[model samples]
Target: MKGQLILLDHLTGPDGPVEAAALMRDGRLEDLFIDSDAPRPGAIYRAKADRPVKGQGGMFLTTPDGPAFLRQVKGLSPGAPLLVQVTGHAEPGKAIPVTTKLLFKSRYAIVTPGAPGINVSRQIKDDETRDALLEIAHDTLDGHPIHDHEGGLILRSSCAEAEGDAVAEDIAAMADLAVQVLNDAEGEAEKLTEGDGPHAMAWREWVTPAQIETEAGCFAHHGVHEKIEALFRPEVALGSATVFIEPTRAFTAVDVNTGADTSLAAGLKANLALARDLPRQLRLRGLGGVVILDLAPMPKKDRRSFEGALRAALKTDDTDTVMAGWTPLGNYELQRKRARQPLTDIVTEEMLQ
Candidate 1:
């Protein structure tokens, strides 16, 4: 059971429900998801455009919850109702960021509204499987009266191994939901769909089979509380090296230090170790956007190897991330998608409530 054992634990917090999904591999916390009360990313809303921001080329809209901002508002009229999806978690005291180009995403399919094309994931490489998945997409979507203005379907990678009936059902459900939301344009500012909470999201995305622990206090039982407490601290010790992660107002700063290792390859070794661990750290902490990495003092020739390792690590990761190359001062830059609420913010919000 060294690496084969995996656990999905849903635990209760002091406030009755923490609404967390913790994934443990071989008794080690692998990934964590804690539900946040903030305006969740990917929620669909029928919002009313309030006003346009001059020079910013964006519009501020009013939702049932609060004000939301959308970019590239060329034809959106003031007070006009439009469908929008939350793009990311809102910064503290800022308008919730939203986009008119809405997407209905699920485990097996994604319905792209206003973009018409029935496609399969590129990751589904087998010719026969791709063809079958394509056929399934067409067969399921062809009967639906999807207009040119309406969106198209893209079968997700998960569909390749999923049961055909289940894939078709998932696609159909998303398509039906999209049509319903798009046609209802007469409503006041309101939410059309609430994004998936922790438990539901875990079931959707964490497709690997695992031992399920739904009983309360499972988090503490699995040492998840200790792991989470460590995330609150800035320094993470990776063997003999120490990496400091500090999030500032403008960007998150990461510094790697080779502690007590006087070997000539210490910098490269520590940096390579960081290359693998950094993604997991950022993911669990829910930190995204511009990340500045001040790697240990490695030779300029070793940068390529470090980058290759980093890229490989990120490739397996589900989140969208792009390497923005290095800065003039030898710092590596990464631009990651704002996919989840920061762990700190989520805990603080719950405590205050």
Candidate 2:
């Protein structure tokens, strides 16, 4: 059988490394790796002939020494970077097959193939081709007609043990689940569309230009006065700050410091203070979308501490605020949910005024 095989990173966390497996018959998650703690979910795991194996379709095993074994296998096929299989024997006569293969160049053991003595070919290396095969397996199991596209070849799952019919049936069930999810999403969208117009109408009474200017004035007086005042008077030689209301949305992007400030720390601190008070402005402005606060770079420790403060300040906002953490370039991104138009959108006052 051919399908996209996702080898999850070995689970390592607080509870300690948990052994997990995910069986996707088609595109849908079929049977998850059953931990020792929980029972099997459905017929998929129930029908298993033998207990789940660790390496390749056999037992629960982790081999620190297996990498060395894999290296030996790779040596056999010199210059061929894509594929290799390693076999080890647990006991004499019965050779232990510790199959180590690369999925997208990352090595992962194929623990279960659904059957024995299955031969894997080189074609499984191509991810696109593998996915198509799994799709075919799923469609066939569901008794659906194989879709006709450019190359009309039916693909199968990589697991050799699964019977042709079993693979097809699993895929069909996945397709059915997908259809249900899409239908539910579409229904939700329709409800939102029906309710949107009335919601916008309700905001018209409270969101006004005067309210926006008042809020802007408050932000200027307390947070960043020079930058805020500069917005109202274009002729003023101020360090770069551009405030504009985004059209067709309830969000406003107030960019601080377009021009370089002589003191980098001061500029960053100014930006941080502006970011810290954004939630109140969002309430006053009725704007949202994790306000992207692009700040000047500061020390790493200070940046983290500032981020903590920004998050704490946002908590005062009744609306939802999510801190999206910092970027590699040291910009802080904050997401604040706004229910209505911001004060700035209602007001069209020019900087000169």
Candidate 3:
């Protein structure tokens, strides 16, 4: 959520949907971007509830995908129709989480049925840009439909570089979807529309952010579709540093290799670059929970500065990340609660039936 979420302009096949990838500031993958799809997280589905398990305080709802758990627990009964927003997908032994508080996400905003003002992402650290986006949000409220929705647009970082027209387009789309959310909430409709406009694009496959050239890289082969396929790769080389990422059952560990340059300055330099890119890699790969960075050796004082850079790098990460401090052995510890499935899980049999 902290990155620039853009749909790759290229289509995989004739009449295919565009691919979407969420990229961090340093341009690393955040998650597999599926713009609009049924059964995905954040999707709203109309379902019918079975009787609540009185002891468990929640009931199972039959959705188009399958049975899901509705945890709000009140006023729900067998055969009751409900409009539920999927909070998460079905895990190994865990039921998918759904709620009545419907959420609609557009390119520039998050529309919900609660508050009535715009809120920008704090990651948009540039004061002027933030102010500009806010002004744009305010403008949307001037006779805009759905302007009355409680949770206003929480501008994504991409809004920082967006032209006024782009922001307006998103606001317009939000307004359109806001109406659906309201209608659904008021029982006038049981369906929720994501939106229509530039942000409501569809995609059939997910490619690495590395594959799509932003204002950055590009490709072509035998007049064929081509891209730098690194979205699922776990290691990256930066200047004199090579960071290796290993995700385990308990935590994700990242090790920095200085590659024969063991001098203090070399180690510090490599660690510095790693510190900056490590957070990008972590967020890119969704390596949440108990992350330990095994950095190139640096003095205690130097590690303090290194830690500062790493923290600075992490500022761009919107996840609930807590820095657990460095150990005496020069390894750094941090915890970013997993928000989505890690790339390894998606690439492996974890998601398989």
For lDDT, the strongest prediction is: 1
Q: Which candidate has the top score in TM-score?
A: 1
Give each model's whole-structure lDDT.
Answer: 0.84, 0.35, 0.61
| lDDT at position 144, candidate 3 | 62
lDDT of predicted model 3: 0.61
> Candidate 3 residues 109-204, lDDT tens each?
666666556788776898888888888888876776665555455666667666798888877776676676565543322335432321232221
Encode model 2's per-residue lDDT on 1-353: one tens digit a residue: 23533222223324553332322223322222212221111101001011233354233222222211222231222222221222211221232233333111101111121121212334357666555445544344343222211112223223333345544454454334323322332211111111112112222112111212222233223222233233333131223433232323333344555344566576556556655655544554445654655554466767766767777877555567777777676666666543433333332333212
- Give all TM-scores, in the order shown: 0.93, 0.29, 0.65
True lDDT of residue 94, candidate 2: 30
From the highest TM-score down, the ranking of the candidates is 1, 3, 2
TM-score of 2: 0.29
List the candidate 2 regions with Cα displacement exceeding 4 Å: 1-254, 258-261, 344-353
